[model samples]
Target: MFTRLGVGVFIWVAASAAVADPVLQQPIDCTLGETCEIQQFMDHDPEQGEQDFACGAASYDGHKGTDFRINVPDMDKGVAVLAAADGVVAGLRDAMTDRRVVLAEDQTAVAGKECGNGVVLRHGDGWETQYCHMKLGSLVVTKGQKVTAGQKLGEVGLSGKTQFPHLHLSVRKDGVPVDPFAPDRDGQTCAYDAQHTLWAKAFAKGFIYQPGKVIDIGLADRGPDLADVVDGRWSDFVADPNAPLVVYGLAVNGLAGDQMQLVLTGPDGEVVNVTQDRLGKRQAQWFAFAGKRPPQGGWTAGDYDLTVRVLRDGKLLHERKSQVQLTR
Candidate 1:
């Protein structure tokens, strides 16, 4: 989940503290993709908590929506994003950034970087889906409108803070982020080839790992626990009036698949297991990565780097590397 899982409960309570709204029902079609497990799928990596992947596309930061990369011919062709179910679109933040980083808003700053265009949709149980950094004018849905699953919501493009055209989708519960990698982060390790070893299969599962959680890293402690803090920055999660914005200003490609195997490594090569969580959203499918809860000692201080790769036919299409710091 976004922020930290330990604090998610509190944050959820706080998000609902001021506003009182009903949780949207399952608005999307749950039977769109294979729901099979495919790890190292960059496009549709999600957290299912060991359950079959709800969909292929994966969201790294529990941004809250299920995504599929459209890993077919023409990675471009302006990918078409669809609605997961029927629900009213909410959180419309329409503004252009001032600074010029990439295609992102000229004014916004992300971890010292800039961002692009994005959107957000609210659902039940604090669940919300977001799509980010799309083409300038490709959205098909309008504000305050209701949509059904697989509904053409918009076309993917390289708009806000994007190097290439992609969609950054996420899901949030009660305004709290849920791990797209279901089950646990270190549950499965993706293998490049049946012959190539080194716990590679986890990558194919496309599940969310727990180590990615902000809480597991002990971000709140004022103590010198985590070390080698690199690539650290924070941003506010606001619903874009123009489009759905992924947290930290990211882009989406498409959904990964049904189920995914996850494999992760922490500081000093310590292994972490995780899974993906797929659940229907008020508008679309949302995913998160789950894994064995961090140790009770509150984790250990260390420098960690995670290399996540998504592949097909033993070919690496997409991959992500995350830096982490923790100390207890």
Candidate 2:
């Protein structure tokens, strides 16, 4: 039975020699780095270690697919998953419940169905693409149905062996897992080569590799929680003058020794600025926040700006800014 280790980490067979490459399109219908982010990539390292196509630790060991993740609020609104290439649907599943696998029992429930409600397409020449973690009952294609590139197959979801909502896209050649970013095994260098990529010209240019990324940032009335951030609840929160003004940032692929800094500035001047402790080890996801309670007059009604930055070796790696209005 197929099994997953962590967030979308799955097993794969050995890769085969190169074959005809499939000209792929963006599989998710959302603005990259805005409504969605590429949280993980296919593991390029063949050993127990993990590495993305850019030689970064964004991928987990044995990860067989590239994970295109969306914030939970966006998932709730529905984000379509598109076919990456012209193909015939080989198989599909749509009955699984849309829920994250966080506990041991949840893992057992999805044991062999680690791909969740997914669709498999055969693009001929021994090339095939599998789209996993689709929302339950959102599949629009059926077995043997012909689909064109960019056609909607389903919506991304928190299903099967995943801890978050994402579309896990896997490319296989002759039933062997292949990295679409680095299709040719011979050209598996850390640097991206347009000649070796499967993405179409337009899409290839947008899939820039990043070692770290700030996925979300927001201003809240109180300290933010990881669950609340993942659920995207902070986006709707309204702050009053009497409440504490907090700013939180959510990031992915935080390497060891990385530090996160949060700063808030009011109409008057700087309010709160704090740098979190260095991460002791690699973290798939990291959350940090800083804030201050209301002053004697209750925070002066005005506009507040929050700046969040991730630093590695004292060098800025990623930064995000957000603004919120405080009313009396």
Taken over the whole model, the C-alpha lDDT of each candidate is 0.35, 0.85
Candidate 2 residues 1-328, lDDT tens each? 2222124334444444345568889999999888889999988777798988778898998988899999888898899999999999988888889998888999999987888888889999988989999999899987889999999998999877888999999888877778887766453456887666888888787666778988888888787789988998888988888888888999999999999999999987898899999999999999998888888888888898988999999999988887888878
Tell how far residue 319 is off in model 1, in angstroms: 14
lDDT accuracy of residue 10 in candidate 2: 47
Put down candidate 1 lDDT per residue, 168-259, tens digits, no spaces.
Answer: 55555556544343312232533222222111243324323211111112111121211212112221112222221111111122233322
| Top candidate (lDDT) | 2
Q: How many backbone clashes does every candidate have?
A: 163, 0
Point to the candidate with the largest TM-score. 2
